[model samples]
Target: MKNKELVENYYKDVFINGNVDKIPVYIAENYIQHNPQVEDGQAGFIKFFKNFIKTEPKIEIINVSCEGNMVYVFYKCSLPDGTINKVCDIYRVESNKIVEHWDVIESHVEKIKSVNHNSLF
Candidate 1:
């Protein structure tokens, strides 16, 4: 599968479905993570998500783009507590495996809180 497809499948199976078993298939054994909150490697990835699923966030992808070996995914997720977050993730794929990742996340502000009422999407 193409790197873009690989990333989509990974998100579908793991992030959306909460299937941790697919980690080995889509992620490299020595995966490098740029997210300071998370640890390095597949084991760390799995460990981190184990806690993440507790929130039961409904993950929704907004857009995706790919160039060379990098795939960028934009996501809007609804937290179990009713808050919303905008997340941007970048992944480096090699040999059909995700080898590195970086992400930025911020809580979405309601329109009333915005200065100009520009759309968050």
Candidate 2:
């Protein structure tokens, strides 16, 4: 499979399914994750994600765009508390293997409240 396809499948099967083992299949041995919550390499990423999805089981990929060796995915996670977080993940692939990743996460509640302006005082 192409790098983009492999990266997509990694999110679908691994992230959504909570399959930690799939990390090795899609991630390179020297993979580096730029998230503050996760250390370098696939092992750290797997650990962080496993714990993350425990309370945030509902996840959806909103969009994806790829160019050259880079792939960008926009997603959302619904927490158990009924809160939603918008997230963006960027992947850098080489030789069909994901070598680097970066992510940004922000809660949607503040944005919704600010836009609606319907909050009770």
Candidate 3:
């Protein structure tokens, strides 16, 4: 599969659908996570998501871009409490498996609260 499709499917199945069993299909055994909250490797990934899914957050993908072995995905996550977070995730794929990940997450700001009056989505 293409890198973009691989990462998108990973997010859809794991993050959105809460399917942790499919992690091995897309993630490398030595997966590196740049996010400070999550540790390294597939074990850490499963551990983190196991807790994360309990929040029942919903995800909506905004955009995707791929170049070489890297795929970048921008999306919005709506927490059960009605708070929204905008996230940009970058994944590095090698040999058809995602080997590394980095991300930036920001709380969604209302247009009225913005000096530029622009939507974060």
Write one digit per residue (lDDT tens) for candidate 2, span 5-114: 98889988888887877888898878888887788887777778778777856778888899889999888777777877788889999988899999877876434755
Residue 71, candidate 3: Cα error in Å is 0.4
Clashes of each: 0, 0, 0
TM-score of each: 0.93, 0.86, 0.93
Error of 2 at 49 (Å): 2.0
Which residues of candidate 3, in runs, are more than 4 Å off?
A: 108-112
Residue pairs in collision within model 3: none
Ranking by TM-score: 1, 3, 2
Give the residue spans of candidate 1 off by over 4 A.
108-112
Alpha carbon lDDT at 29, candidate 2: 78
lDDT of 1 by residue, 1-121 (tens): 9999999999999999999888899999899999998999999999998999888989989998999999999998888677888899999999999999999888753323766757677
Q: What is the C-alpha lDDT of each candidate?
A: 0.90, 0.81, 0.89
Model 1 score (lDDT): 0.90
lDDT of 3 at 53: 91
Mark the 10 consecutive residues where model 3 has the least summed lDDT. Answer: 108-117
Which portions of model 2 miss their true places by more than 4 Å? 108-111, 114-121
